[model samples]
Target: MESPASNSPRMRLDHLRKEGSGETHSRVFELEPCDHDNWSNPRFGSMNALEILRETVRILRYNSSGFMAIAALLICPVSAVLLSNVLVDLSLVKRLTIRLLLVSKSSGLPLRPFIKQSCQKFAEMAISSATCFPLFITLSLLSKAAIVYTVDCSYSRKKFDTSKFYGIICKIWWRLVSTYLWVCMVIVGCITFFFLVLAAVCNSFAIIGFSPNLVVYAAMTVGLVFSVVFANAIIICNIAIVISVLEDVSGPEALLRSGALIKGQTHVGLLMYLGSTIGMAFVEGLFEHRVTTLSYGDGSSRVWEGPLLVIMYSFIVLIDSMMSAVFYYSCRYSTMESSDGEECQSILESVVVSPQAMDVQ
Candidate 1:
């Protein structure tokens, strides 16, 4: 007998059984190396161009990803600015409405436009935010327990445990809501104070055009600087919140950890964030512009468009999360490692210690 030595990709149980012996036997099958090994080069200690693209595609497909990331890459800043403007307008209108009632003027203030605008703005935000959820879920909804569950069933340890993937995302969600509330409180307090000071300055100017008081100009300068600082700090805090959640640390700890991670990498992170913002904005602009046209009692053409845009926007959000996850993991990889199987790279740098390794026992 020739003895079916590696006859095919897989061997039959009958052949293996027949070939079995005390001294020698043919194994049922030979295993191939995991995909990761093929994508990574040991000599280079980094993925090459092809591998990078492949991994990117893998991530997008793996999560059954959405488009928010692509849109986030596009429209983040523009949408943020627009949202801010809408909020300012709505606030102004509300103030006017209350002031009118107090003065007992004809309660016939034009309600249609304001109501329409408010609804439009709210719809935009809610829809955009909701679409962004799935993108976030790509990385947002999985867990370590899920990862362990996946690992338990996986034939190789080299693959990412896709199951618990959302642990980081869940943390981000909780942290963002928490951070948003905190930031809103701070922003509200500061904005209230800012407007008061501005009102005083404006009232002073009301008595005189472009009041020559150096104090007025100085106050103007102060306001500009304050706005810039406030905006930048909040954005940084948002990123820090996400970092914190992924890293599994206290709020303050997360802030410091994010600061460290972002210290040398601010420019890269900025560009990527900007990309997400730009992509989202272009799509948002088109939709909003169309909505503006539709508000003229011509909602006919756009009746079906809103949901379609939302779904497409959600896809972008999905892509946005994937992009963030990719960039994060890429930067997080380290060439150096501790003896106990830990790496020093800073994307959270979480190292889980097993019971056997811990000194607690």
Candidate 2:
């Protein structure tokens, strides 16, 4: 009983629906290429540890000039001071060592040779760190910020804009500083916890009349556990620094976000940390032997060897920072993929519901 004019409108609606269905299928086909491209892109796709390292190297190569400048200006100074121990006060180290020994003796703990050695090393490290704390907050942190920003620009297919980077750093400097302070506190807390636990274990063994050898073995086991925990903590803090610079979060929130981001990627982080630690240690050993302890040709070898080792040490540090930045992206990309799957499903459901609603209308 409908008029022919009304029938025409219905026919037109049916034709449009048919066209819409075809277009939807074509859109889906188009998305396949996009998905493939995204999956192939290193920045968009999830990467393994080795892949991340490769990408970091690529980024470094791409922005070598910028990174080198940052390393020379900031990182090299820190490395030189640390390697030469120029800023460390030997008197302060001795006093601190004595204080630590006295405290341990007063606490009724046995002052074994191992304990004395540990105290001496700890005191020296503490003094050096205190002396270099200023450099750490200023130049070292600035270098990290610069490296992170440069890596981000490289990933985005842009050049490093110094003026823009400076502006960005100025705004985020406080945040970076706050995050670093928190990181230091966390590290100190971990060391304190390690010592307390070690002390307790030793005390328990003493009470049980355990052999000294057994106590030493137990201490070694504890040291192994502490090493793993400490490595994990360092990885988390490094990622937190990246997060603080690249995102809006800082301090504890950045740390929490980093922990969440790295949940399934701890092994990768551990491997990266291991590689960097080894590289730095090797450089330090070379510096200690060639420049500080051993003398060759009236110590002229140190003239070149010391600077060469410092450069190597700085380069290692640069790579480590870059790796941390790349790791952040790798973790972030993986996280996005999981979230994107859920989003795509919801979108598909909505698309399906839309046609049904149109039919009802």
Q: Which lDDT tens digits does candidate 2 get at residues 15-63?
A: 1235536553110001011221243232344456676677678778878
Q: Model 1 segments beyond 4 Å from truth?
A: 1-58, 65-93, 96-231, 292-298, 326-361
State the lDDT of candidate 1 residue by residue for 1-361, as single tens digits: 1111111111011113344465543321112222322222222222322333344455444332222233344334333333233333445455555553332212212234543454355444544444554433333323212222222112121233222233423334454445434544554566567656655654555445453444345445657866655554544554454454445554555555555544444555555555556777776776667654455465775666654565555555444444444433333332221122232222211221222212221
| Candidate 2 CA-lDDT value | 0.75
What are the C-alpha RMSDs, in order, of all predicted structures?
A: 15.2, 14.4
Give TM-scores for every candidate, taking all chains together and pairing residue i with residue i: 0.46, 0.80
Measured by TM-score, the strongest candidate is 2
